[model samples]
Target chain A: MFNNPVTSLAHVKTGRLRALAVTTAKRASSLPDVPTAAESGLAGFDVGFWLGALAPAGTPRPIIDRLNAEMVKAVQMSEVLERLGALGVEPIGSTPESFARTIDAEATRWAKVIKDAGVKAD
Target chain B: MTSLRRMRCANDRLGGARVALVAAALFAANVAAQQAYPSRAIKIVVPFAAGGPSDVMARTLAQRLNVAFGQPVVVENRTGAAGAIGAEYAAKSAPDGYTLLLAQVGDTISMSLVPNLPYNFQKDFAPISLVGQTAFILVTHPSVPANNLRELIALAKSKPGALTFGSSGAGAASHLAGELLKGMAGVDILHVPYKGRRLPPLIC
Candidate 1:
C-alpha cells in the first residue's frame, strides 16, 4: 500500500534492514545516493544514540563493572546476536573497559564539536 | 492559694495543647506516608509516542490494569530518543510499582543506538512478562513498477543513485533495513528520513 512512514521504516525498523535488502536486491541492483523528490515528500526519519550513563563523578566502579558484564553476556547469546544481525544490526558486546574508552572518545569528539560550534543543550 | 489555683489551670491547658499537637503531628505524618501509592491516578510510561503500536498496546493494557487495580492507570506519552525518556522516568520512579513502563524489543536496540542512556532496561526495571512482537511485510512503492524483488534490484542497479527510499530516521530499524539493503544488494538506495511512525494508514 506504500503505507509505511519513511522515517519509522528508515530509522526505527533498522533491524529489518537486512531482510529488506534481500528483498530489494531482487527488485533493483543500483539506486540513488540522495532522496528523490517522491522520497523526500514522504515523512520518515531517525537518529542514532551516542550518549550513555551520566552519573555523578564519584559513582562506584564496581556497579558499572557489574552492569557492563551482564550487558555483554546478554548481548552475546547466539539467539540475541542472530536476532540483532537479522535486523541489520551488529552488536559491540563491549566490556566496561571498552565502553569507558568509547565514552571517553565520544566525549572528546563532542567536546571538540561543542567548542568549535558553541553548541549547548537547552 | 489563689496563685496556686491559677498555675494549675495554666498547666492543664498547656498539657491539653501539647497532647493535641502531638496527635495532630502523628496523624499528618501517617497521612503523608499513606499518600496512597496510586494516589489520585497512576501513569503507565509507554516509551514510544502515542498512536504507535507500543503506545496503543500500553494504553490498552493500562485500561485493563486500571480495571483490576481500581485506579486510573493513565498512559503518559514521553517519547524521545526511542523510549529513553519513558524508560528513564520509570527507572527513577519510587519502586512502588505504581509508575509502570511498557518496554518492547526496542529496549535492546536503544542500548546500541543510544549508548549512553541514563538507565539500563535490565537493571532499572524488574522483569515484567514479555509483551508481543509484530512481523512486518516488506512492501515497496507501487510506482517503482517492480513486480518482485528481482525486478526492483535490476532497476536499482541500472539507475544507481537515481532511486530513493523513505525511513523513519537514521539508526531506526527501518533505516537500518534500508542501509542493509544498500550494503547487501550493493545498490545505493538514498534514504529519506522523518520523525514519526512508519506503518501505513497513518492519521496525518
Candidate 2:
C-alpha cells in the first residue's frame, strides 16, 4: 500500500484508491487534504522517498563542488521545480556535507529498523 | 664516415626530443581534460526501470546538467537486485566526475538488508546534492473500508492477519514504510512484496 504519488495520486483523485495517510513528517503538497501518518495518530511515523546524486569515491572535491552548485541551481530553476512538483516531489538542494550526513543518519536509522523487523532482501 | 655518424646521432637526438615533447603535450592535455571536470558525456545511472520516479528524476536532472555543462548528460537504467546491481556498477566506476548514481533510500538500507553486497553505500560514493523527495502514500482498495489511517489501523487490529499490504520489494522504501507502520501500530498485516516498483494490478 506504500505507493508513490506519481502513480497513486491519480487513483486517489478518481476514488479508485483511498489514501489513508502520507508517510512523511509533513503533508504532501499535492495532497494537502490528506493527513500525514503522525497527524493521523501514529505519533512518530515519518518515512519518505529521497533521491540524491552521487559520484564514485575519490572524485575530486572541486568537481563535487561544481556538480553541487549546478545541482543546487538546477533544482531551483522554475522548469525543474514544475517538473518535480508534478511528481509530488519537493526539491532539496543541499551541501555535499549535509547530504553525506543525511546518508549516514538514514543508514543508521534504517539499520536498526531492518534488524528489529527481521527484514531481508530477497 | 665520422660526419655520417655525427649526423645519425644528431637525428636520433632530434627524434628523442620530438618524442619527449609530444609525450609532454599529451600528458598536459590529459591533465587539462581532468581539470575540466566533465570533458565528455556524463552518465547518471538509475538503479530502476525506465519511467519510474527515480529514472524520471535522474532524467530531469540530466537534461538540466547537459545544458548547464554543455556536455551530454545521459541517464542509464541499470536495473536489478533492488538497486544494488547499478549501485555496485557506479561504485566501481572510475572516480572521475563523469559517472554518477541516482541513489535513493533503498540503496542506503541495502547496506544492512543484503548480505555480501559488493559495494558499501557509505564508503563507495561521494554525496552530491539531494535532488528531491516524495512521500509514500498508504492507500487501500475501496473494498477494505478504511477511511483514514486510524480506521485502517483499527481494521487491521480487528482483522489481525487478514489484511495484506503490498510493497515494491522486500527491502524497498515501501516495504520499510509498511514495516514501520506495523511496528508502530502493533498490527500484523501480511506483507506481499512484488518484483519492481509497480504493485500488482489488484492492489493499485
Q: Each candidate's iRMS in angstroms?
A: 11.9, 1.9
lDDT tens per residue, model 2, B7-123: 999999999999999999987866776688687999999999997778988998999899999999999999988898999999999988989999998888988988899998999
- Docking quality band of candidate 1, CAPRI definitions: incorrect
What's the CA RMSD of model 2 in angstroms?
A: 7.5
Tens digits of per-residue lDDT, candidate 1, B1-204, equal 999999999999999999999999987865554454335565677767676756655554555555544778788788886778888987887654456666654455455556478986545555333332332224554445564455666777888887776645554544554454455456766655555544432111
| Each prediction's whole-model lDDT (CA) | 0.48, 0.88
- For candidate 2, the TM-score is 0.84
TM-score winner: 2
lDDT of 2: 0.88
Predictions in order: chain A TM-score:
0.43, 0.90
Candidate maximizing DockQ:
2
Q: Please state the error at residue A119 of candidate 1 in Å.
A: 21
lDDT of 1 by residue, A1-122 (tens): 12222332553245423222222211111222323212322122222222122222222344334333433454455665554434333334454445445444434433443333332231
